[model samples]
Target: MMAMVTMVAFALEGYVNFVGMTLIERSANDKESAAASWCDYERKGTRDKVKDLRRMTGAEIDWNKRPYATIKELNELRNMFAHPKPQKPKVREWEAVGTDAEFRKQLRDYRPEYEERLTWEFCTRAYDDVEAIWQHLLEVAKINPFDALSGGSQGFELLAWVDENGRETRA
Candidate 1:
């Protein structure tokens, strides 16, 4: 039943995972080559604080896990939408439809909890749940203010420290 929730959540936001992957690759680089990376050379003018965060808090992240998790979720969602859809015999008015006087009588069997959970309310809750997963993503990636579509203006703030020689220190 709960698995159904995860499936729907991913189905709804599968595009975000795609966008995030592209953004991460475009923004991130290997630690050794990071001096020339966008986050360093170009972005420093904007997110200069990230440099300090690295030096003081050692906030460097792996960056690989988040994309992997998002891709996995997208796969699960595609399966759910592409799989053979169960028949939900439509009901009519006037006299009625299906069997019982009630039109929706055919759907009484809720053995498969997933079918029961197919509601707007459930989808909304599922969205919140999936978003929660990414909360941890930002923390794990050590990337502050993880707004990918924000054009790099917003994300976790980086710390900066100027040593006695007035040189930037790497944390």
Candidate 2:
């Protein structure tokens, strides 16, 4: 579950960067300037990058809405696991009654929220949110998601060659 959540977060970041870079490359007049702009854009944090991509593509995303909120929460979980810090143990109190006596107990340990987020439900939801965001961005950018994923719209061709006779052949 943790691995899935982490991968989904990474996938979202990668998708945003890929789309932003493609847009920049297409719109810029100079390749060098486009490369430099991409470098500056890539330095931004994940949330900021998402916002920048949304603005660039003219897509509206409500941060407080379903898929967006879920993705944000997933990113938070990923960040927590990625950059962990020592957390003070939480104190939990419990009461017990035996046949002979009643006892009170205190336990100190990590909070349940961390474990709670590692559930299958959360992981599945994170995956769904990533798909939703990916589709939304692709739609707004007017790029077919299937083509993008299959490398069909990447603006370059492979298996093409020019013979010594200067005749070009394409696969």
Best candidate according to lDDT: 2
Model 2, C-alpha of 37: deviation from truth (Å): 1.1
Worst lDDT run of 10 residues, candidate 2, spans 100-109
Per-residue alpha-carbon lDDT of candidate 1 for residues 1-171, written as tens digits (9 for 90 to 100): 345555655443443343333344545676445434433434332123223333433555332454223334434444555574775654433554566645565445423534553556655555664565455444544445445345655546567777999888974
Error of 1 at 144 (Å): 1.9
Q: lDDT score of model 2?
A: 0.80
* Tens digits of per-residue lDDT for model 2, 14-41: 8888788878898899989999999999
* Whole-model Cα lDDT of every candidate shown, in order: 0.45, 0.80
Q: How close is candidate 1 to the true structure, as a TM-score?
A: 0.34
Off by over 4 Å in 2: 94-112, 150-171
